[model samples]
Target: MEYSESECHYRIKIILIGDVAVGKTSLLYRLTYGYDETIRPTTGYEYFNKFYLFGDEIAQVHFWDTAGQDKFKSIVTNYYRKASGAVMVFDITNRASFESLKDWYKELKKFGEEAVEVIILGNKC
Candidate 1:
């Protein structure tokens, strides 16, 4: 079925995961607030929600902005459990950050959830 911009009510939960300073918060703000860099990096986690109207249905996009620190890994993983999608970000100049994507994906898969769609964004890209 072709989904029109104004058709259908969908509920989506997304989580942002990546290395520290990879601009997870920035991305969230960019999409939700119009620009990411305009806001400061998020601490711990932040929540955002938006609605999309599909015909007569309303689609709700729920976002979870997570901390990129190793210390916050456990907490971050917890938020990914039921996530419908994940945005994995990394700095274009940082290869290590890009390399860590696998680990983050692995952690999410470990929770027995394979329904999540992924969007990998290289900050500089």
Candidate 2:
């Protein structure tokens, strides 16, 4: 589809949150740039931009990949502001990772846009 600048109306900002080693980066890579065997862990945060066709409208999607380490929680939380959506990821084999979903959800609601869309992702299944 050919999309002009004026045809872009929807702007979607998505954030990915999960504990360390939960494969959040891998998931983002697969979605935005296809699979890569050399994907590395995100340090603090990373941003990716892509455009998609939603019916007749062109949507610009901004994906933010946040670090899952405790030390980076504060930094990660900052990116939640004005987020249009979020993906809370967890490792299927790790119970603790799943348990942290509630905390992540709470943070997303507390800091992100009130009408933000959310989805849970179980990785390594």
Candidate 3:
């Protein structure tokens, strides 16, 4: 369930970042509007909005789903600074994808808020 901006108490900025084909877009779609197996590779970045209940408050979460290709790294990091939280995703079946999470975490820490909360998703099991 979701509430309009007026009904919500506050807004939150969340980012989904990871290596290419690690299912960042899939995760976002699954949670927001249902997953599509044919989801194309995100070009630069994409925006999505969903309301989640946080205790008694409904926070309008603004999601930034970033392109994970190296070519987009420069563009993607720009979205990191203001994020209140991040979902760092990796394909559980891919060892390389799992290893690259460290790099992603470092980048997020370097650019995101000092107290940004991060949750990891071992996706595609």
lDDT of candidate model 1 versus the reference: 0.81
CA lDDT, candidate 3, residue 37:
84
Off by over 4 Å in 3: 54-56
Q: Candidate 2: minimum summed lDDT over ten consecutive residues — where?
A: 1-10
- Descending-lDDT candidate ranking: 3, 2, 1
Candidates sorted on TM-score, descending: 3, 2, 1
Write down the lDDT of every candidate, Cα atoms only: 0.81, 0.90, 0.92
Clashes of each: 7, 0, 0
lDDT at 31 for candidate 1?
78
Best by TM-score: 3
**Model 2 off-target regions past 4 Å?**
1-7
| C-alpha root-mean-square deviation, each candidate | 4.5, 1.6, 1.4
TM-score of 3: 0.92
Candidate 2: C-alpha lDDT: 0.90
